[model samples]
Target: MDLCLKLGLLLVIYTAVNASDISVYIPQIAQKITTNVTDRSFVLVQPNCIFTQYPTTNVWVVVALNKSFSTISDSALSTPIPYSSYRNGLYNYYHTLLVSAGKYPCLPSDSTSNKVIQIGSETCKGNQFCNGVLSNNQTYRAKFILLNSSGIFDTTKWSNEIILQQGKSFQGNTGLPSGRSGGMIVLTSILSVLMAFLLLSVIAALIFGGRDLCWKRTMLNQKHSDRNMDFMPRSTYRSRYDNMYLVS
Candidate 1:
């Protein structure tokens, strides 16, 4: 009995310890890619983090066109010059405006014109402001950055660059998977305890009930044997007395 209690206590402690080890803040980002049929093209950015509610931060979507996969330097993006205007090689790097939290379909903002450009338009005429036309069959890579309200970047929290091809749609998750919240961990622990207790109760009842049934059956068999012995002796004594009376 004492051993059973010790094991149960150990199980509960093990569960609690394991649950505590789980990380509460696991960063993640979900990206969706789409294309426009017109002359201009850009990747729409959407950002999601496991700890989104805890911080009020701005998300920046950065794109490097036709560049080999390389670490995006802070200096390259943080400069006063807008990314669309800065030319590195054959293609230019572009970044979107500061996206508010929980916003979707973050369109790229043109740095030179200081306006959001239409997705598929060719020229900056009428309602359409041409940012840059993405050539079909070209490849573009993009990433996301999390920054504080004061424009300070969190070096630890950034997404892996995802490559998208022109006229093709891509979707995927970036970064570590999200961990369970405090409430969910607590709920899981409670359920485990309840199930363990229920299992123990069932095992104990089966053992005790089996013992009681065996004892009742043994007592019933003993009573039947005693009654048979008593009846046989009475019949033998009555037969002997009748024989002696007939001989006299």
Candidate 2:
């Protein structure tokens, strides 16, 4: 009779623990990079809540296939809360969101939340640990998963869907330049080539043109020497010889 009572109590305790599952909230806002969005990399604005609520904790920036999670209208995360936490450990380990904390934490009085982080493979650094590379022209949704000493504490809701488009170069976030800078690079190259061609033309003119100019100067000098010979002043001997020849 005592053994049966103990088993019943144990079952009740287990049920109570299991009943309290992880909680989910709407995904926080992710500021898409308006200026320099590229195929392999982008930017995201850190959520405002982390600075005060979970100062010691860090954040993880994650991207997955579009429509994989609940839409904005769903109110909560699309996947099972427990499963999402599980995937948090299993997926993208390299991308821990970066923020300043501790002695130099974000101030509540500050107007903005925090500095932004660039989400490219090359741009990702410090605590980020996921694969660090992103696909080009692939559509994906992004969110922030908060982490504490134990593990994942909570996750924000999914941000709006974004598409990373293809650009000129190899794949992944390996520093492929984009936006205004990309156009500037091409323009600069064209200008460099034209300048080189112009330089060569000037050099050729100097080499051949110098020789032609020298020849013209020499001809003029020769003409002047011939004219001087024809107008030579007559000597006394030459005048006598001329008169004798004329009388004969």
Q: RMSD to native for every prediction?
A: 28.5, 11.5
What does candidate 2's lDDT look like per residue over 11-110, in tens digits?
8876544322112333433344464456776666644534343456655555665745443322232221322332344532123344433322444645
Clashing pairs in 1: none
| Structural similarity to truth (TM-score) of each candidate | 0.34, 0.47
Model 1, 141-190: lDDT tens digits are: 55555556455353232334333344432111323223545578788899
Q: Model 2's lDDT to the true fold? A: 0.55
Candidate 1, RMSD to the unseen true structure: 28.5
What is the Å distance of residue 230 in model 2 from its true position? 2.0
lDDT of each: 0.48, 0.55
- Predicted structure with the largest lDDT when compared to the true one: 2
Which regions of candidate 2 fall more than 4 Å away from where they truly are? Answer: 1-22, 30-46, 50-54, 67-94, 100-136, 164-202, 236-248
lDDT, candidate 1, equals 0.48
